[model samples]
Target chain A: MSKVNIALDIMGGDLGPHVLLDAAKKSLEHYSDLHITLCGHSSVYQSFINTLSGDLKARITLEECDEVVSMSDKPTTALRQKKQSSMRRAIDLVEQRKADACVSSGNTGALMAMAYYVLKTLPGISRPALISWLPKAQGKKVLLLDLGASVNCDAEGLFQYAVMGSVFAKLCAGVESPKVALLNVGEEDIKGNTLVKHADQLLRDSQSVDYIGYVEGDQIFAGKADVVVTDGFTGNIALKSSEGIAKLVIDELKRLTTENFTARLLSKLALPFLKKLYQRMNPDQYNGASLIGLRGIVVKSHGNANSEASFYAIKQAYEEAKNAVPDKIKTKIESVLMEH
Target chain B: MSKVNIALDIMGGDLGPHVLLDAAKKSLEHYSDLHITLCGHSSVYQSFINTLSGDLKARITLEECDEVVSMSDKPTTALRQKKQSSMRRAIDLVEQRKADACVSSGNTGALMAMAYYVLKTLPGISRPALISWLPKAQGKKVLLLDLGASVNCDAEGLFQYAVMGSVFAKLCAGVESPKVALLNVGEEDIKGNTLVKHADQLLRDSQSVDYIGYVEGDQIFAGKADVVVTDGFTGNIALKSSEGIAKLVIDELKRLTTENFTARLLSKLALPFLKKLYQRMNPDQYNGASLIGLRGIVVKSHGNANSEASFYAIKQAYEEAKNAVPDKIKTKIESVLMEH
Candidate 1:
């Protein structure tokens, strides 16, 4: 039987390996063929293993690496110097085909740098983009691109992003046309700056991708389009700001409920429905992002991710591997580039 | 009292003569020595005048303008063809020295174009920018510039924006030695693109303006700085997105609180506090933004404004006319340019 070996940098993530260890144990019990090669500090992983249930202990492989990459460390230098780090070792497993894919909730910049320098970009791909999903109004999700991968992007970069994001929406969210929108200052085709204007013209002209015209920042939450493309700078702002706004809104509700006795009664009555809605938009639930257009499948989870988030990152890797996202992105990008 | 004659575009705004009349009534009540020339359709102004209450009946003059510029009309053509439109007529009042400034809630583009065509930019001012106060924590506000005036801008323009915003914040918000920061992807001086990078260096090197280095988007609401500088595109997104997010957050709070019994109790307790916050951040409180660096004061009121908003716009005009924002901006920009 062909097996999918998944490598995880368990020593990463803000909550240490406990959250990941718990999730990995559960994940192992759920999937018989799932093999987790946890590359991390040996002592930490061993201590975790003795505490885990028998099933989890049987399915896990502890790979030791003394070095660790801090979140704020410079990506380029860390990639070159941290050759023996758990992050690099995990990517090395993917490079050697020991693992079908890799997952990390560590430093995004470091992970992206290591993935590019080691695993390398897919054939004919100019750049890789980070893509995340959020459940919209109708229980369907929208794929938002370049969440933090490339800080500086141009017309061509956005073009590539649109195609990758569209594919992710179709394969993952089941959107057929996957109505794509290029996030901009306004909805008008000519309303934005040179980068946006050029991207609009190019997207309209492209045959492979469905290029919906410009969409504003507010429209992002409404899930106006199945796929939204933007420069990393703006995309990152839109993502974090949306999450911040959601949290702020939730906090306000809690504040109102707890303010007085009568309001607390109201809050009690409204708790169930509100909980459902909160569950719907919670960032922890939608924690994983596929680093598409790379040679191997790479999932960049939230930096502050606990075990639950990192587990979602692993599941995201599992599903993304099934879809063959890297090869798909390469094919789509190459075809578009050739035609253009 | 020194009389400051101002032009009132009675035919402007979403709600025309009614709002204008009401605003003029309130405006005259405060500044008794202030004179207003109401320029609009003869019949419209006359109808309002016939119904005018209190002493304001004698405080306003009916200057009939045969043509009126709609919100959708192109400002350049409106100025050229609508020889007697209320907007054109208002700018004409400023040019003729019949009024110190003009206030309108008409087409933003048309108003901007007409002002530039008629009043022209102040010497050493390459472009005029619109500044708005973004609500931050602690009931404090930061001056955000060129919200939608210019689509694309260079480093020099933003450098000038810093100077203009600094002077405006000091005069308006009463912030002494207001901390100014460049809005960019990262707070580091080395962050952002060439436009921001060079601007950062210039701002750092500049002795005239208070340069507080680079500030990230998330930091905008943290009340970290008194003034934030950004290009029109990003500035427009930041401003509008904040408004949209604020509305969404408030709306979600209402939705969650009214969901059930618990929510009802929560809402009952929280509504008062929430309403106070909503009121504090309401755009109506600050309805006027001086078209900084113009030869004459030009205040752009909210397009969806009502009587109360119009009254606030009038109040802003009184302040600008009193503060001489146009003259202040002129001296500030010229000094910076001369130094450059």
Candidate 2:
């Protein structure tokens, strides 16, 4: 891969710019050909720059921005008012081709709005979806899209998402002609609302997508399909619900294993395995949700993301940049739409 | 508690009528004051009747129905064509006042349609919702409604759900002035789609409900509110997604524990704790989801329910019947709406 550059929105995320700065440093060390342009308050970068070696310092660039898009900021306000914000600056870097991708752990809606305003959608795509990889059976991952980018999606919007997700699964997840499915309440032909049912038909008729019918929420991790597409509302709730349950289970396990001396001793042996399981299942570990169907690559990390999670987001941006995800999606969508 | 009479749809569920019959027997054994009216193919009951003691036999009544509502049957077809079906007959028993509640593991849509047609909605309620209990932190459970009964709910519909859920939480879940919340992508006032925002305003304006603002999917199990209300699509997907992740975690743990002899031996001590955790978290074990906003109580079990799960459904029906949940909801909705 050629030099993959990611513009990091350091002022964004709950842990603040310091954590993101640490992640940026870690990411540079991990990816040999990766370059990071830190966009945030200049003072945080100043103190951190002293620790980096000459080789590392030479690769990193600081693009100082005065404003920060807080987690509570409305998307419209962030888009119209926060032009000089760190999140906007990061996306600006991507648009200017100074960075191949933009990574932010800021407000999702604001990031999305700014990205849409700055990067614009790819040709043949109506909207850009927040696509993320979810763990499936056999150590495989499935691509779930529109995780909160576009809430009230019409049938055509959902159909576009299907094509985009299929393209993403193939290009980014390394699946060939990825089997795509619509997320509905039931797998039956007569299931779901009008939007999903219509989208299902559109997907079934498409020659470009390997449409595999519907999969309910419980079947999401059953390795039923390579990509699952749904409107942002359902997708966001489903994703968060999965995270909630995973956390609940982990908490319950922790409580159970320490309830008694016998349990504690037994759990000591299983601790390593438990840690590995946590790492695999934790949503924080799966750090980035890339805004696909756009002219430029933009990865949105979780708002509450720590340094580790932020590093994973940078890593995600590096991979997507290397894969040229947006270009592939644009190509795939154009070919798929032309068939109709 | 008085003798709680429950009409059982024996011919429904994946395990066939035999599993329901087993559940009926178990329910009768567990709840001494409970009487069951079995509505299904009489041949299944006739053969088993010989083994029952006179005391148990006297408490049971068989209401023979020729037709069965299959899981795949459309709601309209089940309502129009299958009047003589087991599910319909069970619901009819409730309508006729022969049974206090009806229990079914049949098609949810079919059950909802038949129940709505036969029993009708409460005085101020427009649509019925499938309300189920979800485990929260500290051994508590939160009430999640509209699991798949009503899709495409408007602001008024969602607001009504909030009111109904609040009533249910107070009466059934034993919460005083239950805190109600609308489930959305984010907790912010600016978050969520148009329906939720409108509903939030309505809920806030209402004096009857203890409206606690919006909650995200991850907070559903965090005990943030006593009741969580959402449209059927989001609620169903969120629920099934939670189930999927929980199952995945369990499956992963099983694989990890059995990977080596040391791990296997260690897990043996933690086996009981794990089993308890599974029981608490498993969706199958939380068998019944009651249809609220109706004139009568109708508990819908999982279609693929085992005898154990089916028994829990029967137990759920018995409790609802004893509590006169329908009457309570009717009074609550009428009183709450009258304030407007």
Candidate 3:
């Protein structure tokens, strides 16, 4: 397979250049021909290259972008002010077609704004959605749309989400026929608010995706459906809450093991198995989410993502770019809409 | 403590008389003065009374309701069409001072409609909220407000949630200070939409309850605060989704344990600890949600709640009713808002 060059926002992310530098160095091991454009503080990039003296230095190109988007800054303010931010510069590379795609562990709202402003949306799409993969208890994963992008959505907007999520599931997850479900208050067809019910009917009648019956909030991880569609507000809350609760469960288990000497000894015995089990449920292992339905590929990492996550994020961007995910989604959208 | 009397909607649940009858019989074992008004199919009550001999029959009064509200039935149609439904008759008893409170494991929307229309809201309250007690990883439970009552909420509605949740938390959880937190997309004051931000400002500035700043959705299980206030729509989705995911996790754990010999051995070894862990995390183990700030106390049990859960539901309603929780909530609301 040919190597895919990706623009890495070195100065972006919670841990900054350390994560990006590590991810960049790690990428070379898997893809010898892969070239990385390090868009960040020059000193930060050079110091990472300074650690490796061989062809690694020659393989990495440093592009200085001194200004950075702060996690606390508002998206609009960041867009107006942080013109020279590493994330902004990374999006510019994707826009210029200098790189196949871009990866950033920066401010999500700011990244979306910059991505849309730079790459724009694909044909027939009003706005792009941030589609993330949720680990199901079934050992598989489901693709969720508008994880934090669109808060206020209507029926038409939700229909678009189904199409986008279906395509993402197919191309990324390698699912032949992605089962799409509308996230509702209840499983009954007539249940939920008018918006969700309308969206459910529309998805059912559409040829764009295989519509599963109405699914409730918890069914997202049940593996009954491959793509769960909902408004950004609900999706965001579900995603965060699930993550929170999962962490809570783990913490509980940890607390239980330490409650007594017998339990602590047993916990020590179960360490490997428990670690393996928790690994399967880890969200960071899946990498960053893609800004789908955009003209160019843009992946947004969690701002608090670490080096290990950033490495997976770079691979995510490369995978999407190499798989021609945008073109596949465009084709799917066209084929389905044409029938409509 | 005085034994509390409850109007039990025997025909209102998904499983109908079997679960209700079993639960009612079980509840009577614990509370000798607990009187059960079995409003449902006369046949079901007769069979149940026949099985329970001399002493049990005297404490249980069977009223011929005959009608039932199905899970999928429309709330409005169920109320208007099924006039003789157990749900309606059960709430009617509360309205007529025949019972202290009513318990239902039926259609939630219909139950809410019945409770509001028949029993009415408390004075000075616009709409009553569905308040649920959720067990956090902290070994204690916290109160979640407006699960599905009010949808299009403004600053005032959220403030009212704070007061209702605080009062409910105090009575149910016995929190002295009852630290309240506004559930937002993020913990920052400016993180949420205009409504939440405005509500946060009001909650912080108001002298009503102990506003402990903004809380993210994930912190709910962490027991970060006593009362987590949110708009109905968001709260409903968060609560339902969390329940769903928790069930999904347990289901997955069951599947994993039953996989093979090694897993089965592991499951057996962990059974004692896992059972308690799962029990503590179970939603059914806690009291079903109560419609706080109403003219009378009304508790809604899980639609698919088992015998133990149903018994707890009645016990919860009876206990809260005995405490005159609604009056206390009204008093708290008046004292706070009137001063403001």
Candidate 4:
């Protein structure tokens, strides 16, 4: 592997620079060929730099920016006013070709706005989508996209999402030929609204990708398809609903296990197996969501992510950079658009 | 409670007459004031009638119907062709005031189409919404609506759903002033698409229900509000997605528990507590989604529902009938529309 440069937004997220620095150090240690330019306030970066050893310091660079984008700032406000903010500067590094990719744990709306403005959309792409890898049954992972980027997408936009999502799954997830499906109320073609129905027809008519018919929300984790596409609103709600239910079930299980002596004894005996299952279902393992369809690679981490979760986000950025996902999507989308 | 009559579509559902008869017998025994008119082929009902004796036989009335609505029949096709279908006949009894309510475990689209055609909508209602009880974290349940009835709802349609849903919650769920919310991608006012954003404004301006601000998908199970409303497409996907995730987790847990001797022993000891929890979260307990906004009370049961599930659906119909849900929605909607 050759050296890969990553631009890190240090001033974003709930935990601020401390969590970002910790994740950066860990990621650098794991990948000897990795280099990161930490973009944030000079004083904050300087204090952290003083503690690093010669070898670690040599691999890290500081690109100071005095401004920061707050978690509450609107995406438009951030775009118009926060040009010097660390989030914007990190994305600038990607545009300037100084970094292979940019990673941010900031306000999602602000991060997307800044990335789109700086890197711009790839040819034949209207907007970027938020794509995440979700755990499926049988130890497989399915790629789910439009996780809240464009809320009211038209049929054309959804078709673009399908094309970009297929590219991401094939290049990043290593699925040779991805089977993509549109998320709808039912598996039938006549199920959803006009937008989805039109998109379904477009997908079926085009030979850009291997398009499966409609899939319901429950089929997402059933591992029936390699890629699932939907508007940002539905995808966002579905993702959060799944998480909320998982939390509810786990809490109820814990309460039940602790309420009885027999249950407690059995839980203790089955601790190892339960622990393994819980780890597999943990949300931290799937921390980063790629902002696909951009001219450059960008990954968005959860706002409240801890150091471990932030490291996973960095790993996602590294993987996408390694695979040249943006280039793959650009080439595939052009062919798809030409066919249409 | 006075004597309440329920029209049962015995020929519908995957289990056919067997499950319907079992559930009917169980319901009659539990509610002494209840009477059921079984609508199906006379030969099938006669065979079951020979098995029933005494009070059970006295409470059930068989209304023979020659035709049946298969699960695959489209809504429009069912309405045009299956006039004497068991599902259609059961609804017809409600329209004629021979029964207070109707329950059917047949094709949802078909049932909705027939019910709308026979009973018609309330004075100010344009379309009927599907309302169901969803389990929340604090051992409470929330009323969620438009679960798949009207896929493409306008702003006015969503506002009507809020009004009808609020009435249902107040009457059936027993909430004095239901805190109604519009389901969106984000809780912020600026989030979601044009339809939801317009509906959000209309909800705030209207004094029909206790209009809470926007709520995301996670908040649905968090017990933050009494009533949550969305377009049918989103609501259906969200509901199914939660169910899917729950199934996935339980399957994984079962696999882990059975993999080793220690886990299996522990699971055996914890069986009673686990069983109770499972029963509470069981979808069968939450069957029988009410098709609100119609002039008559109509409940749609899952097609694959067994005897236990069908019993819960019948219980739901009995509750709605006792409360006179249709009259309540009609009166409430009149006042709400006047206010707007």
Best by DockQ: 2
Sliding window of 10 residues with minimal summed lDDT for model 1 chain A = A240-249
Q: Score the docking of each candidate (DockQ).
A: 0.34, 0.80, 0.51, 0.77
Every candidate's fraction of true contacts kept comes to: 0.21, 0.79, 0.39, 0.79
* Chain A TM-score by candidate, in order: 0.93, 0.96, 0.95, 0.95
- lDDT per residue, candidate 2, A88-164, as tens digits? 99999889988899999888889999999889999988888988988877667788888999877899999999888
Best prediction by lDDT: 4
**Candidate 4 lDDT by residue in tens digits, B1-340:** 4799999999888876889889998999999999999999988878788887688889998898999999888888999999999999999999999999999999988998899889999999999999999888868888888999889889999999999999899988789999999998887767889999999889988888899889888999994789999999999999998998888887788777777787777668667866877876788989999999998989998888889999999999999999998888888887886786
Interface RMSD of each: 3.5, 1.0, 2.0, 1.3
Q: Model 1, stretches more than 4 Å misplaced? A: A1-4, A26-33, A134-141, A241-281, B15-17, B30-33, B261-274, B338-340
True-vs-predicted CA distance for residue A273, candidate 2, Å = 1.7
The alpha-carbon interface RMSD of model 4 comes to 1.3
Chain B TM-score for all candidates, comma-separated: 0.93, 0.96, 0.95, 0.97
Query: How many residue pairs clash in model 1?
Result: 20
lDDT of 1 by residue, A1-340 (tens): 2556788887678877778777777677777778899988887778778877776677788888989988767887688789999899889998898888998888877898899888887776678888998655545567788876777788978887888888888777667778899887767544788998888888888888777688777666564688888877767666654554455555655665676787677567667756766665567778888888788988877778766667788888887777777777777777877896
For model 4, which pairs clash? none
Fnat value of model 3? 0.39
The model with the greater TM-score, 1 or 2, is: 2
